[model samples]
Target: MMMKKGFLLKQILWISALIFMFGCGSEEQFEQTASGLEYKFHIKNDSARPVQLYDIVEVRMNYGTHDSVLFASGNQTIPFQIDPIYEGDLLEGIMLMHLGDSATFVIDTEDFFVKMMQSPQIPDYADGEDKLYFDLKVVNIITETPAVKARRLEATERKLAEEKTIADYVEENNITVAPTESGLYFIPITEGNGSKVKNGDAVKVHYTGSLLDGTVYYSSFDRGMPITFVAGSGEMLAGWEEAILMMKPGGKARWIVPSSLAYGSYEREGVKAYSPLIFDVELIEIVD
Candidate 1:
């Protein structure tokens, strides 16, 4: 009986070991082999241009066993965040990964991209359909964290501040405003046409927005028209709705927006946060 029990214990131990190995294998997307590197990648370049080496590239790259294919490659921009691109090989960004790292992806290229890049030069394979395969390796990588994160952050703040100064200059010379409790200021540009721009009314305006330093962030002028948004019902920002309420139809005015009225100081991926902004706005139409 003891011998039989011992044999059962051995079988159970082996099964547990196999499960552990399989779990570990399914962790990262790609793995390495004798032939080179191997993995599938997600394709996201929907534009009619080829993916550039100067851009950050990320894929589900793996270089190991069969079970390692667990997660689909999440977004990984190559050239690592610290090392800004400066006109060299775009592939240099991901070249810093280790031997076992892998990326899986699907490549999407546009017709013009194929013509411009003559992409046939790279090592890739087609899988019987529209899909192409990419198996890459880090022959090497630029393993330095170029900027201490804090300093880089400060530099970005300084740039935004500079942009704001320009917007401030525009505001200083043009309009008059008074601050209110809602963190938005009011200026009586024109008299009303009876309806107060309360919640639910659709409002349209032509606007050009910039930092105080004068870098334009958004503009309805791009479309050569005004944009429409619902008011107090909340399709617009708090500051915008408040400012519009002060103006009547046909009113043209400039608004100096505080950070609390804009996207606040939260740093967006590529844009600085907490930026004081200015907008030259014309209330062209208000729809019910």
Candidate 2:
């Protein structure tokens, strides 16, 4: 089968753009951290406040390989907690900085995509010896250390915190939409004219899943592709199964999944037990 010229052109342009974005950094002046990650400080601040664990830091970040620019968040300030989810994660890069500091980090490409992004498989473009680069500038930092917040690890405390967290978020964000019976907020951001998703239908979707605090756990965009799966299959979280059923091809929505409908009591390297999650999904199509 012949590929369409327009699609082929887009693919070529995407590849070119990916390859053109990152700088071939010099190893000189780079310092190695205990975790095997290397970093170079472009701009450093000595007197400003330093980031601590659980602190919510706002930073301008763009990450990619020396050849490919994967995800460049444009001029946007992203706020996330300073907890390390995986070895050599974004946390490691942020921890070694103070307010107003700008730095570039060199980390293992496979470790980042496999451990941090939780990508099913590494993208072919990022599967080589070139390391991943993360350029970040600290904009703001709120010191919310576990001790400062008096956090507890008990499941009972977690249950209460989970409910309050959702409630506070909804109230502050002015989210007036009601949630489903399972406490899943199934709100559509855009409408779709295509066929509605059915149980056995094969569908492809682009989604970014994060914790309630803007910490992205997974993003298909970062992977430079979408994910395909059969609807209602147990491959997805329970919240996704219910939310995707309400969407159609071309539709986009946000789902606020409570811990009850999410990974309740399921802890892992990158996941916390009974953690609430948010998924921003774009249903691409219902496969033929």
Candidate 3:
């Protein structure tokens, strides 16, 4: 009887160990889609509606390899129409999610690398064997209509006109400053010492921004604090971003930004719609 009791206790312990292992493994399991993409939802709102074709959806996405973050949208949400049917494992996973859903998708890096190689330059982090991951949240969905399309087209046309105005101004004034590849025009007043600013470096800048007619809109000097942000992070205007990357610490420059690169068609408190902007900027330091 004593031997039989000991044997039963051993059997129970073995079964418990098996159950524990299976539970731990299951925690990491993700649902695989027909396209072979694997995904798991971290947050789901079943009551929220799923986006349909022709709907404009806003999403925040972070895409990278398992070990590193290559790119992120930060606090900004990108809006896109769902009509074109984008081809990718990430898009496929996104289609499965409803509004307010947050999910992580795992895609085969081999396929991604193949598509990326079609570009002129392959990124340094591209690895064929590594799995790419996308963490995305569907923020909102708007049904597109004819009015929305018309308004967008109108905005585009206005923006083009504003760009032409800036070009004409540059020509008439004989501004000898040339534009960068990204279309930012800058005149370096004083060359700063030290290393040139690069992407991903946190930098401090003192700037005074105004309209083309020399109407001052904002000045960092008035605030008594220099503005600091990660370079090339889209936290500032596109023209400012391009100019800052070209400067070193203590460099002073004047940037003439077209409407498209400045504020587009959006009018802020002191900025008018379709207005070209000028900024007198001084790079204070490269924090990192």
Using lDDT, give the best candidate's number.
2
Better of 1 and 3 by lDDT: 3
Candidate 2 local lDDT, 7-111, one digit each (tens): 211211111111222365467657888777788877788888988887888777666767656665555565665667666666777889999888877878766
Tens-place lDDT per residue, model 1, 1-288, is: 101112211211110101112223342554443323333322222332333322223333221123332112223222322232222211332333342243332233221112212221121221123322223332222322445456456646755674455345547766455457644545455554656566557778888877666787677888686777666542344467567777767777777766555544333333365556677787777875
Worst-scoring 10-residue span by lDDT in model 2:
8-17
Q: Show where candidate 3 strays beyond 4 Å.
A: 1-132, 135-140, 144-151, 191-203, 210-217, 229-241, 248-250, 258-277, 285-288
User: Which candidate tops TM-score?
Assistant: 3
Provide the global lDDT of candidate 3 against the true structure: 0.65
Once model 2 is optimally superposed onto the true structure by TM-score, how far is the C-alpha of residue 40 displaced, in angstroms? 0.3
Candidate 1: TM-score?
0.42
Q: Could you tell me the TM-score of candidate 2?
A: 0.49
Q: After best superposition, candidate 3 residue 288: deviation in angstroms?
A: 9.8
Task: State how far residue 35 of model 2 sits from its true place (Å).
Answer: 1.6
RMSD of each: 19.9, 12.8, 15.6
lDDT of 3 by residue, 21-127 (tens): 11123425778876677887877988899977657788877766655665566666656655322355455676788998887777666554333211112234554
